[model samples]
Target chain A: MKFFSLLFFIIGIQFASMAQTPESPAIVFGPVFGDSKLQELTYYKINDIDSVQFTALKFYISGVELIHQYKTVWKEANSYHLVDAFQEQSLSLPLNVPTKLKYDRIKFNIGIDSTTSVSGAMGGDLDPTKGMYWAWQSGYINFKVEGKSNLCKTRNTEFQYHLGGYRFPYNNLQSIFMDMPASQLHVVLDLKKLITEMPLTQKHHIMSPGNEAMLMMERVINCLSIKK
Target chain B: MKYRIIIVILVCILLSAFHMATEQLFVAPENWPETTYDFSKNPLTLQKVELGRKLFYDPILSKNNSISCASCHSQYSAFTHVDHDLSHGIEDRIGTRNSPTLMNLAWHKSFMWDGAINHLDVQALGPISHPDEMGEKIENVVLKLQQSKKYPALFYKAFKDSLITGEHLLKSISQFMLTLVCSNTKYDSVMRKQTQFTTQERNGYMLFQKNCGSCHTEPLFTNLEFENNGLAVDPTLNDSGRMKVTGNKKDSLKFKVPTLRNIEFSYPYMHDGRFKRLSDVLKHYTSSVLQSPTLSAHLQTPVVLSSNEKVDLTAFLLTLSDKSFLFNPKYSFSK
Candidate 1:
């Protein structure tokens, strides 16, 4: 009788543990420059007029959520991730969503929200030491893309674009929604589309958050699409 | 069974003791509004505040190790840059605006003269990276702090981890700044009914309530809102204040209304430190207010104060200067 009771207790504990554990889906994001995957110091052409070499590309992807039938299904808690092209480990985001929930769409913000920006210093990916936070402006630089290009005017032939603003009218945080058929997904950030769509000569060297930053944010958002 | 029950009770007691210890770190003044800062994110502890105090006084925050936060914000002048109109930073580089006093910051919603920084924890970044200021990056600052002999142990004591992080650095600075509460002034004593103001001060108090009370407010001595105090734009600097942040025309010429708690020592008033004395500030309010499209509505009507009233008002303002806060050894350099 004692052995049978011990067996029942062990089974009950296992069932309870199984009930508590939920499946968390992982989503991987791959940044590519046109047909080629993004690599530092790789030269790329823009509209045959501009030849650019990118040295750094980093951005923030936050507020990850899953939507179904025009309603929200799952949202990741503390969903801020800093994606650095140099850091391969940062490309994958493990989302805490139940595998049973079927979602048709995925949505996220391209930058840190105003609430987080005002909430003070945070740890993990949101730490200011990540080189993404603007020390002078007291807000995160949502997107940082730096490179060298002979395509024209600045000294050292270097072009830098740091796009971010949390205030109204010039807020640079962009909401991105992509159709997803499976819980496990991959998103592509096409730099080719961004460089080709925007005029580099007039818009390069953007460091502060404003109208130019907003335009750059829109251009970056336009280039993001789900990978097949 | 007895041992299990005792273990559970001990855990409960430990958790409650931790709760009580955190509560003791932050002491909101009697009748003051609750602090705007969310303490749960960076809970206050004695060790963290001590670490913050050390960092505030250390010049290592600068690139060249010559300037610290205390360089511009000295305790003698209520943590403001005195004598100089514009703040002097690294290598004698002059800033665009006067360094504001650092007190009652836990109630502040935004920081800096133009409210450029929305949070207090991130405010250090403004000075640390500004070319004229500390001229250091947060990453480099972290690396330096990590390599320091004293900081690693301090970090371990405050955060229980020796690996220094930018979050820990910023939060510790905030912990010290949040403790800078200047509420024990004569004005506070009178308000609490523990003492009485002189007849001249009483008259000045009434005049202040009638004229400056709307923006300066009582008790805290600041409503903590941005306003255009009607100083004509400086042709040399042309600082556009809040308009530059919001990109809105209406916010032009608007600057954060500074607290008047320590108006005595924090001389050279206004955003640019254009006024060297309280009388000059009062004179501007009475006679020198330039009418502009974006001027504050409250200042549109002249603040009429007679010569005697000005002196009396200055006397009342003097009551706000707390000697205890200025000389508090705890807030001083921790050696």
Candidate 2:
């Protein structure tokens, strides 16, 4: 009788532990060229005339928050992630949320904040060795996209955009808010819309912080959308 | 009884450890202003300082391992490359401006002549990645440091992590730089009533107070403000100084007023190292101040000084040199 009671207690504990386990959800960022997925060093036909191949696409996503109704439900601590198109693991960011916390909206910044920009050195994704930092002027690069297009008349037909500026009149940090869909959060950044909208010939190279970077950042913000 | 003894031993060890940990790493000179460097973020440790000292002297930071911070910033010349008007870098590529002296940096709010770098931690990144300088990226520098046989162990000892990161790398370098205190000059001794200045020096001091004290200031020897001290722009360089950073015409030709401390050794003077002698610098203030739309307000009025007064001022300026800081074995390369 004692053994049977002990066995019942053990089974009860197992059942309780199973009920308490929470499944962690992730926010996945997908880079796509129109309908097809974007691949590094792979050429894609743009506007049927120009052939564009992306060599690199990386940007900083920081200050992540989940909003319920109008109020913030959860905020990631030290929330900064470098989403690189080349690295598969970096594309999906795991979020540790409460078991039953319900959030309707997801908000994040497309670049490092002004505060972090002047706060000296940092570790992890914000490290200066991440290639997203400008060495001479002292600021994060914010967003970097490099590619070769047939339309570009410059060296090797290349176009590089390193958009960043923390100071006023050219602060390129853009906040993105997406409505949470029924399924898991998946944000798609369509380069097709970006490449089509931006003039590839005249504005082929933008490597510093200025009016051009700010305008390019605005165009980058428009490229992000929640895929239904 | 044995357990009690063991507990007591453990407590003693822990107490001693706490005592050593609480020992101050950097102590400011008496009556000096609070340092602008935020030390709480990256507190100095002896191990880290030593690590940074090695990194400062290590040419591994350069692309071809030919140049280091010490290559431009030597210890003897107030941490600046003297005799070179324009400091050359890897492959003998000359930079646009002179390498500024690195001392009393803990009080400085910004780095570079134009104040382009906002923080000291990220200042090295500018030279490390400049095409004509070290010609290496911070990422590559980190990779090289990690692969180095000696650095990994040293980094682990200093940072307590074998894997080297840029944050730790920069912070360690900052630790070594912050330790470079330039106090203890003859001027400081006279101020402390330890000694008296010569009659000539005293007269020069009074004149300096009347003429140059506003911008050069005292103690740190710099007001840390930007000024265009009437230098005619070099058409070859076309360097616009602070105006390039701010994009404001009002800041045209303005450069950070460098510390007057160790002026005897940190020559040639000015942003471009144009003046080779203290007399030339004095001449510029008195007779050759090129009037500009954005010249410093202090320099708007002409400075009148006789030859005797210039000699006396030069004598007073020589008192700012601190030989102890120059010859300090602590700052010198260990290996």
Maximum-lDDT candidate = 2
Q: List TM-scores for all candidates, in order.
A: 0.90, 0.92
**Per-residue lDDT of candidate 2, residues A78-124 (tens digit):** 99999999899999988877767888888889999998998889999
lDDT of 1 by residue, B248-267 (tens): 88999999999998899998
lDDT of 1 at B245: 83
Q: How much RMSD separates candidate 2 from the native structure?
A: 3.9
Best by TM-score: 2
Q: How well is candidate 1 docked (DockQ)?
A: 0.67
Q: Model 2 misses residue A36 by how many Å?
A: 0.9
Model 2 reaches what TM-score against the true structure?
Answer: 0.92
List residue ranges in candidate 1 displaced over 4 A: A1-25, A47-49, B1-24
